[model samples]
Structures are given as structure tokens and as C-alpha cells.
Target: MISDGVSVEALTQWQEATVGSLLSQALNRWPDRAAIRWPTPTGLKTLTWKQVWDSAASGAAQLRADDPTPIAIFAPNSEGWYLSLWAVALSGRPLVPINPALTEREVRAILMDSGASIVLAARDYRGRNLLEAVARLNIVDIQHLWDVDDWISATQSATGAIGAVAPQSTFVIQYTSGTTGTPKGVMLAHRACVNAASTLIATLEPGDDETCCSPSALHHVGALIAHALALARIGATYVMMNEFSAQGFVEAAASSRATILAGVPTMYSRVLDDPSFADVKLPDVRVLMLGGASIPVTLVSRLESHFGARVAVMYGQSEAPVITATRLDDPAWMKAHTVGRALPHREIQILGVATRSPADVGQIGEICVRTPVRMVGYLNLPDATSKAIDDEGWLHTGDLGALDVEGRLYFHGRLREMIVRGGENIYAREVEEVIESHPRVAEVAVVGLPDSDWGEIVAAAVVPRTGATVSADELSAWVERHLARYKRPTSWRFVDELPMTASGKPKKFAIVEWFGAIDGN
Candidate 1:
């Protein structure tokens, strides 16, 4: 059984470790164990621990020979992407991952911001020629850009020794989703990533033979720390998906006999919506992990019943990889409602917005976290870093939540997203939960629209289930039965789908624009 208390010994051992050291340890302990499984059009490709180490060493040598500065990877999830990540990690240079879904302009902005001269990119992903597109940008800062396949081939044939790196050195410059504003480069040190992955490994206690099916993008922290690094620490196998499709995920899970499945709420909903999901039997799956967004209670219950697996919920951000997670044995309500208590070696506090002091139990306030897993700072933005992490070492998360007497956290909503209708505050999450509970609703995103009379009014963008229809009057009456009049949505838009980020969170800014376009305001 997992203990709630922190493990001092584990922290002491991992506090000064680098990703290279972790790779070495895995190589020594589990030389013959399967480290990765990549499904291709031809067949399944499996790599042993020793093979992964050799490939990483070769790639690292090539990187050290070509450039000494931080490198960037622009590709979808694939064997080439994994090899590139290991190459950068072993080379003692930071890696900047750019989402494949981003536009050329967005990609150029990140490259310029990160100053990554060497970029290993895919030749083509989905339908776009990523290499040609990046070449078209012709950013002068980008000195060397190699197609991912060519780079892998060149690196695999080369050989060199791994460089020595400090534990506190930055390993990755992860960019935020930029849903609220321009994306910031979050500097994550080797120690922080190692410690965070170790903490989660201890909590999950995955077996050596376990296989995890992950469909989340490798660029996001959820896939990097939680699934990839965590699985590598234990020498387990992880199945990679280049793109997420309900049919693809179900097929992969069945073929791999996966023990753990990880994804965001939207991915889970899609899998359940797939017709083949009802016919498949995944008896080997033991845990279904959810992260990246708020999970609806109904979704949790449905996942548990469908997969016959325990649902484990986690909450985190790019600034802090993972703050809290629910255990496998947690009660159903606790798993569905709360984000669980703070993880080991982490402290969570609800700070009063006005005074910036600790709020009383069950009182809503801005969520603050003090943990070793936090990012060093925003790259090249000292003022922004200071504003995010205070002098007291507390990282003000800007998310509003409350803690119960037992220390379990209940997330309310984003502090900035709160709606103040004539001085009364309304949390978007509260209203969303009610609408999602309705039988006809598939998903909903609530926002605060500008109103001249009430200052700001509640607005909702709802996606109804396929072939199911419900009018505004029906939803208004449904919400009225559960929420106060002030909290109910005054404006509604029945969209086929909500705009979403790559990591699966709804894009609130885009929804607000939709409403604005309709109102001509």
C-alpha cells in the first residue's frame, strides 16, 4: 500500500540526479527489459533497455558534435521523437518541444523566443510538410534544421561519450498553451523533473512488466513527466500514438494488453463515444489516469465501468508538473470531486485574495503551492518569474480552490475567469458541472461575457451528444433547478464542438470571441 507521508530517502537519492543518470541506472538494472513499443504500419517495433541506451548515446554524441546550445523538436509522437528527446537530454542541452498542431507563425515565434538554433523536425505529419514549412520561415536564429528521420539515422550510426551535467541545469524549456496570453517558456530543471517523476512512481507503484498506452502529445508535460519519464524510471513499456483517434486507442490497448491508460477528459469521452468501444474487452487495463483538465463526475463513473479499471485523477500545470493525484483505492466521490491531497514533499495553501494570507478551511481562495517540483523560472522573463513565484517560495497558481479539513482540494475555477454579476461571484466550473449532468449534454464550457448592466454575465457554449437535441429553454430550466439565478447562464451557444487546446482544455478566449461575433460587440 502507498503511504501518504513523504519519503525522505527517495528524495535524498533523487534530488541531485540528472536525466542522464536515470538513463544509466535503467540501463544497468534492466538491460534486457523492453523500454518502448512503437506501432508502425508494418508491425510493432520493440526496443530493449540496452538498445534505447545505445541509440540515446549515439544521438547525444551527434548533438554535442553539431551544436552546444539548446535544441528544439517539432514532430508528433513517434520513435524518432523519443530518440530526439533522449539525445537532447543526454547531450546536457535543454529541449524545447513545439506542438505539431501549431501554425507556422506560432512555430517561428517559439523558435525565436527559445533561441533554439538546432531543430530536429518531422518531414511530414498528418498532411502538412512540417520540414518545408519550417524552412519557409527561414528564421536566422535557426542555424541547423534536420528532418527527424535523417537526424535519427545520422545519430544512430555515430558514437560519442555523454557529457557531465548538473542536476539543477535546465532540461526542458516547455512553453505554455498560450490560451490566456502569449506563451511563456517555463524552465524545468533536471532535478525537478526527476523528483516529480519519482514521487509519482512511488504513488503508482507500477510493475516492471506493465505497459502504458498513452495518446497525449509528447510536447505536453503530462506525457513527458507523468507517462514517459515515470515509465522509464521503472523500465516499463509505453505504446506511442502519433495521433489520437478513438478507434486507434482502442486497438492499441487491446493489442498491447495495456495495464495503464492515460489521457485527458476529452480523449476518454471520445473513446466511450466510439461504437467499437462497446464491443472491445480490455480486461488487462488496471488503471485509467485522467489529467490536463477538470473531469466530469459522470465521465469518471462511465470510464470505471467500461474499462473495469480504477479512475485516478491528477491536477497539474506547466509551471509545476504535478501537484496532487488520487490513489487507486480512493473513494468514488473523492476521486470524482477532489484532486486529492497534496503529493509527498508538497505543500498546498488557499490564500485569501485580498490579504494573501491562508484562508480558513473550505473557504475559496487562490491556490498556492510550495514544492520542489516547480520550474526554476520563466526563461528571459525575470519580472514575470517574480510575479509568479513570490519571495516566500510560494508559487501563486492563480487558480481558485478550497481545502477541506482532511486537506483534500476542491477546484472552483480560474481566478480571472470568475463572473461577477452585479457584485455576486459565479464560478464557471460550478455551472458547467450542472449542465454536464444533464442527460442530453455531452460537454459544456462556461465563460463570463461582458455586460454593460451587470458588469459581466454568465455565458455557456454547450456541445450536445450526437443525435440528441435540447433547446436553450430546456437547459435554462435544468440549470435553474440546481444553481442560483445569478449563476445561471444568460447567453447560450449550441456549438457542435468547443475550441480546445492540444492538451485537451477548452479555449475560453476563443469561446468569448464566438459570442462577441454573434453580438457584434
Candidate 2:
């Protein structure tokens, strides 16, 4: 296995550290440095490493004095939101971070399923009042509820109660949307968080003065681990946004002099499409880490050209956080084509779909990983957990990919997302990448529609650029030139925009339903 700039000894040393301990170390090292920075409607705000640690200690002490049930935080990205997560971990309780964009029913399901007894949320955001929604649920498990303002204001002296937390204990239960349209709670241990943060800090080599600007929500794994925990581990600065806007991110990066920017592909797309994108200049930014979704080959080139920064594409899921990440010093071709090799202490193997055996080099198969940075299991779902994690402890990711001889992973598409047309297997991402290469295509999603003749035919739904008109025939002709005839999209639907999930992934099920309704199938 490749070392990837980190060593096994270093990973082992961090194996027994809890999230609370990690933050404490950072606070001790840089008590006066700014730990968190964000722009509010009132003005810009800042928090020192000592302030965050003390707030977390106070919150932890308060929760321990109360019922101490699983704590649920429903709020946007803010300094308070970030501290609450650390507070729960330090209190020896599992934290459940619900997406603020979830519907009332969805929020209720998570609170009830996770048995969360304490809730901390914003009074209202984006026209949704979480307090109102919680009042309607009437969940008995929730014994205490406080708004963000009240929670932050009630900070008391640090009681040093965080020392009670164990290293291997459960830290958070992150609920992610499943294929069946229900959210499954993935339990992550403190060691898992430590492992993930260690890998990210070692591979990325975050400098002491480096400031990172993150646009992802506090609930996302990328934000919780890569942006928050990793930043604390290295004593770097964090600049977060309450709401994501292309222009807002650009302005924040420029003003904060951010050296690193982390985001999903959709966020980058919006930034590139902004009207004032050409005028923005952020000279301090040296790295742009894009993940949590597909990164188009063309977008990588455009990002580097515009920002004068090296782009590093990372690949991982909620189950295993940041298993692989490309380096900043890697070649441009490697950064654009592959997601890089496995982390120093992690093991990745591509297993064949039908045979259930390891695939040879350059062969596409299901991407499986064995790593310390993994979820404990799905909460209260034994069968589902068993099916996802095998007997030997390998987490079988549903995504399909292949490994090069040098251990670099080349992602194909989701195993369920592959289309079988006339007994020929066709990957949707291969088609999507080709379609996204077209200059007029702003965004595209490829799905399989029910077809009696071919069993399932390749279909694509595309959103053209603003003020651009694109026909189905022209896109079909373009696809035929890059891919095989069978792999080309049999049907194309042009729309104003593509539906996305709360975590910024293309909603394939919604796209399929739309196609069925239009075709009368």
C-alpha cells in the first residue's frame, strides 16, 4: 500500500483520541487564534479556539446535568451549530444532526428513531421554524429544547466534564437518505472521527495560518470531519457561511484571505456561472477540494484556470469519511481523472459485481473498503447493517469503480445506476461526463427508463445553460461521437433545471418519475 504522506504510526497514535480531546489539544496550542469566522446579517463574527472549547465544555456540563439523552441539532452552518456537535461528543452522548432542509415528517422520523432527548436549533431559517415543527411532533424523548441564541448565551465556566468521554464511544448518529427513500442513521464512533480527521490533516497538510472557507452545511460529513475536526487538529481558521451563494462564497474567500476552499460540484458550478465571477480574485487560495458528488473533467480545468488553484478531488461517503483524496502537488491529469489512492491506513479493493471476488487491475467492480474511519452500524437496523458491512468488516460501497496498478481509483457510477440496454452494461456517469463536456449543457443526469424491448433504456435529462437553446437531436449526435452507440442516450429531456437532494446530489428517482409521466409509461 502507498503511504500517501501519512504513516501507520501516526494513525495509530491518533486512534485512541476522542473528538473532545482533539479540540482540547487545539485550544491548548492556539488559544488566541480565530477558530471560526462567519458573516451574519448583523455583521461579521469571530470565535477563538478557547471560546469554542469553553462553549463546548459549558454545553457538555449542562447536558450531563440534565437528562443526557441523544442530542439533536437542527440548524444551518454557524459557530453555535459547530460548537453544539463538539458539546454532544464531549457529553458522552451521540449527536444527531438533521438537515435543516428536511420536511416536518422527515425531521419527526429522525428525532423519534434516534431517541434524541435534547434539541438545539435556530428559531427560524429560510422560512422554516424548527421550534414550531418540534412543538408539533410532541416527541416524549425530547426532554429539553433551546434555540441557538439561548444555548450560546447560557455558557458557563468550563467544568472539565469532557474528560469522562471514552475514545471508542459513539459520537454521532448521522442520518443519510437511502435508496428506499427513507433516512438511515449511521452511527459513528469517536475513534472513527479521529481516524478520518487524522487522515485528512496528514494528507492535506493544512498549515497553521491556512484559512479554509466551507459552504457545506454543518450536518454534512465533509463539513463535520474535513472542515471542522481537521481544521481544529491543525489549528487552522474556519470561515463558514450560513447560506450558500456563488457570489457570497467568492466575497468571503477574498475578504477572509482563505487558502483552502471545500465544496461540492454544484456549488462550484454556481460560482463559475456567477455574473461577477471574472472580476473576483483570491490570491491566497492554493487548493480547491471538490467531493460529495461527481466532478466533471471540464469543470476541473475551468476551476484551475479561473482561480489559479490546484484542484483535489476526494471520494467517500457517510459510512466511511474521506477514504481517498488527491494531493495538491499531484499532476493535473491525475487530479482530474482519478480520486487518488487509498489513505495511508485504509485498504480498498474493487470486488467483481457477479463473482463477489476481487477484480484485476483496470476492471470495474463494486468499491469496497476496510478502514478505521467507518460507521459502527445503522441504528436499529440489524439486517440492513449486515448487508452493507460484510462478515470480514469490509464496507461494500454501492458505487462502482476500478483501481489502477498504482492504486488510484477510477469511479464509474453507482451499481444501481448502471443501465443494461440489450444485454450490454452501460454506466450512467460515463454518459453524464460526455454530455457535460458539451459547451451548451449546464447540467445533466442520466437514468434508465423502463423499456419492454431493451428491458431498460438509457435516458438523459439535461438542463441547458441560461439563454441557450439545445435540441434532443443535437445532444444525441454529440453523445454518439464520444461513446458507443448502445451507450448513447436513447431519449433526452431538456429542462430548466435538475432536481437535487438536500445534500446536493442529483435526485435520480425524481428524474425517473418525471420521464415516466411524460412518456405515459
Candidate 3:
């Protein structure tokens, strides 16, 4: 019914499917067509739909030979990573994705919690030897650890047939970005993922020949569902990046003749600032899709002018992907100011904190979503799961927003103290716990400071022990050992004492104002 010749009936059929079944359909429909394309030092590498399906089938066969426990992939985005992802799905094992930027301790915690028996990882990424780093964790539960190259090589001879998987079975155990100071594994069913991807594809309506360049990390749900699965559903070409760099993205987009590009606002800002961005001609690009963080109005205008593409803004979380998004035909003001209206078959309500009911139009409150794509629940945390999803089947997102009279949703901010730095969520308590562990620190409070480039940057306000002296460099080093690079505080302030309320809680608003004054904001 929309463009690109995808029928509403086809989307309805796909909503009740699994990833394996979809991949099988793609192989049959576009066997020789390009499925994935990525950059190499020499040039670009391309994989056809048949080649990807064969590789994944082989890998899935090998997985069937081992214990049927959850499998974790700890690597950057690459061809092998996609193959492994499909392999896990075909093998009927839940995939647990870990961010490659995480430290050894952080990786260990996920592996232990998920009880993943197998790990498919890159031998080295950036400067870290991931194999050695994971080995250093010394986790006894990890039974099989394969380097991606070796795993691909060993599975080449497999001839096992792919089996059908249940749509309601868990496909991915996606961990949140630690919005609550502790990372909770969100169990997404195959039906949820398939339906989410189908909805996104219907909304975007790209042609079968459309080529998309994506720089988002594969671990995040935004990229996994929106880019990876959605593109597959439509049988479009997907151009992936091992990691995101402004220059790298510009080069890939131009070289691939990309028709669609996707990334966070920070990535786009970096691209706009890059010198090569102006020189590169992305004339084929028709859509600039953005999500994962707030979109600055100026940045949206700049992106439109520079790329000559329609900018679409989306708002969602890992628990429920693609709750609301601006359509391709939306007016510029609507795209700039709101995240658009809820998609078809989805419902959104603004819960009034005071009235304990739906808020009036233009009244800001918590955003609640009821969708078929919502995650089944948090893994092994029934209490937390119940707290997030109410008895009415509505998932209460901790984000604050309001609905316009026209039914468009306007995003205000977060209800909790979660910092989104370059599209990565960092909880205030998570960072504060690390800083407070220092012997010379009495107490510490972490807050998000607004920035033009990064949506927000982590800032720490510390109180030193009596007669003790501590430097910012010392605290930074301490945090680096325990957390990821993005979670570390970039700005530090030492205060004699933190402002407190009568309830014996630190007044976070006062600290934010203090930082604003010091920065002359």
C-alpha cells in the first residue's frame, strides 16, 4: 500500500515470523542480490544473500553440536558479526550482545549473568586483545570461545539444514545501557523483533535496490532492529561499519552510493564538522534517519542543507523499539520539534503524575507505550519487569514527554538521572559509585552537562575527605579501570560540600545550576 511495492498483507504475515524464516525468505527471493557491503583497507567487500545464508547455516550447524546455551558475541560490527548473529538465531539459542568498548570487568559481569556457554569474538579491536581480555576474566561457564575468522573457517564444510524456530522464543537478550546503575538483560522475542523490523520497513518504504549505510553499534537495539533486520526484511543492501568515525562514515556513504544513512545525532554532528563532508557528494541519499538521543533543531537543519536529504527523527528504547517516529512526508517543523505520532497498531499515552491518569494535551508526563514489539520482559528479574510494565500491558518508559493536539509526541527529557553521551546511556549512580570508591573521596555526584557536539557529557562533583587532596586525573584513571570509555566523566568539580535537602538527599538541580554558572551557560 505504501511505496516500494511492499503490501500490507506481506507485512502482516512477517509480523508473526522469526529471523531465521525471514533470512530463508531473503535467500529464496534475492539469492544473487547483494545482502551486505562493508569497507576494507583495499576496497569494499560485498556478500550476496545466498552467501550470507550459507555461511550462517554452516555456523548454525556447528552451534547445534555444542550445548544449547545462550551465545554471546563480543566484537565490533563486521561481516563475521552478522554471520554469527544469524547463526545464533538459526541455532535456536538466544544471543547476548556485549559492547566491545566495555572493560574486562564489565564483559565478565554480562557473561556471568547471562550464563552464556559460547563466545564468538574478534581477536583484537582497537588496541585491546579481546581474546586475551576475555581469557583474563577466567569465567568457568564459558565453554567455547572462537575467533570469528577461525569460526568461519571451521564451519565451511557444514551441510546441515536450517530448522524452523518458534516466533515466541527469545531471540536476543539485549542488555540495557545501565540506566538503573545495573545493566538488566532485556529478553526480546523473535516475534517482537520481526514485528518491529516490519513496522520500520513499512515506515521507511525503501526500494529493493536501496542501499543503506549504518554506523551504529550492532549491540544496540536501534541498529540491530532498525538497520540490520529491517533492511533484511525488504531485501535491501546494508553497508556496515566496524566502528563509527565521522570521516569513515562520509567515505563509506559516498563510496557505496548509499540511498539511506542512519546514525545518532552526535555522529551526524561530527560528520557535519568534518572537512571532507562538504567535499563528498552523496547525491543518491534520500533519507537521513536519526535516533538514540535528542535531536538539536540546528543540527537537523544543517544536515538537511549539507546532505540534501529529508531528516526523520525516531524515539524509542531497547525495551520497546520504534514506539514513535516522524514519517518521511512530515513537515520540517514537525520533524524538528516532535518525534512524530505513534505508528499504526501502536498506542502511546502520557501518564499524569499528579492525576494518576492520562494527561491533557500539552501537559508533560511519563510516556507509556503499548505495542506488539515490546520486549517480553527483563531476563530473570520479575520484580523489575513488573515495575516497568503495568498490569494493563503498557510499558511505562521513564522518558518525559507530552502529546500535541494533532497527536504528535513532543519529547521533554528523562525522568531519571540518565546521561546520554554520544547516544550511550550512563546512569549517574553507576559513575558515582566508582568515584566514591576512591579513598580520598568523601562523596560524589554525577550529572549530565549539555553540549553542542555530544548531546550530553558526564560531569562529576566530588567532595574530598577532610585534609585530603585529589586531582581530576586521579579520579579519571580510577573510573577508566571499572567502566567503559564513554561512561567516564570528562569534566570534574571539587566542592567543599554538596547542597542537600531536608530529606538528606543531594540536591541535583542545585549542582546542575552550579555547573551552568561556572561554565557561563
lDDT of each: 0.84, 0.83, 0.82
The number of clashing residue pairs in each candidate reads 0, 0, 0
Q: lDDT: which candidate is best?
A: 1
- Model 2 lDDT tens row, 296-329: 7788888888899988888888888888988778
TM-score of each: 0.96, 0.95, 0.80
Question: For residues 251-273, could you state the per-residue lDDT of candidate 1 as single tens digits?
Answer: 88888889999898888887787
Instruction: State candidate 2's TM-score.
Output: 0.95
Full candidate order by TM-score, most accurate first: 1, 2, 3
Q: Pick the candidate with the highest TM-score.
A: 1
Model 3 per-residue lDDT at 258: 94
